[model samples]
Target: MDGDFWHGNPKCYRVPKSNVEYWTKKIEGNRARDKKHTKTLKRLGWHVIRIWESALRDEEAVATKIRAAMMRHINGETT
Candidate 1:
């Protein structure tokens, strides 16, 4: 997630909303839909890692988590 940039107002940012809100909005599926999809993927033997936008706020931690998830997926650790 990128940092907000100051608008013409000098105080207000040009973005529409916080990163969390933006992601939540972008992920349009309902909670039930997500649960079903996750369950299906898990049953199909996949490592499903869902990272929230807030997690990316800390670049280092985000990189670590992403790397770990990718490694785990590549190693066939799940199902």
Candidate 2:
């Protein structure tokens, strides 16, 4: 799971008036790193499940997603 702000959530991120360029670059870097890491992990045969902060608002939905992922992994369905 990742924070909406720190992970560059398109729905939640708003550039600060002060130091706009710096913040934009910093957040963009974070997003790039996250994408790279997720790709690397999947390449290494890991089942990467990314949960957004906003998704946590629905506890049941989050649990269902997690459970489904786990089931897939256990059943050798996830790559």
Candidate 3:
């Protein structure tokens, strides 16, 4: 599911949501939090592959990308 920033805000400009939320501004350490969350999920045996909000623009390519992630997850290749 897409977020508010991706859906309308022009500032986002082809950036991933993670990049947008965590990497934007020097407000705080959102990036580090994201890293922690990802690591936590991975440690819990969850395959967590993230796609950029812009990547969804191409439906076919997005499908392929998601499928690849799923394949990797199924194959037990830790993300």
Candidate 4:
């Protein structure tokens, strides 16, 4: 699970006002690292599922999405 801010979710992430530059760089770095890691995992033949922290509020919805992703993966769908 990824925290919205830490993962730099564009939907709802803002750099802290106290240290704008630092936080911006930090979050940007985190996002870059996340992308790199995900790419590596995919290159190694792993299905990557990233669920945001906020989305965890709805367990049923998350489960359905996961199931759908799993089904797509099983069906050799590149998603």
TM-score per candidate: 0.48, 0.87, 0.60, 0.93
* Every candidate's CA RMSD: 9.2, 1.5, 6.7, 0.9
Residue 15 miss distance in model 2 (angstroms): 1.3
TM-score between candidate 4 and the true structure: 0.93
Error of 4 at 75 (Å): 1.2
lDDT of 3 at 14: 48
Q: Write the per-residue lDDT of candidate 3 for residues 1-79, one digit (tens) a residue.
A: 3342433334464455576665455223444555688899888877776665666788899899789988987787655
- Mind giving the per-residue lDDT tens digits that candidate 4 earns over 12-46? 89788898899989999999999999999999999
Give per-residue lDDT, candidate 4, residue 39.
98
Candidate 4 lDDT for residue 37: 99
List runs of model 3 lying over 4 Å from the truth. 1-28
- How much lDDT does each candidate structure score? 0.58, 0.92, 0.62, 0.92
lDDT score of residue 8 within candidate 4: 85
lDDT of 1: 0.58
Model 1 stretches with alpha carbons more than 4 Å out: 1-29
Clashes of each: 0, 0, 0, 0
Shift in Å, residue 11, candidate 2 = 1.7
lDDT of 3 at 3: 40
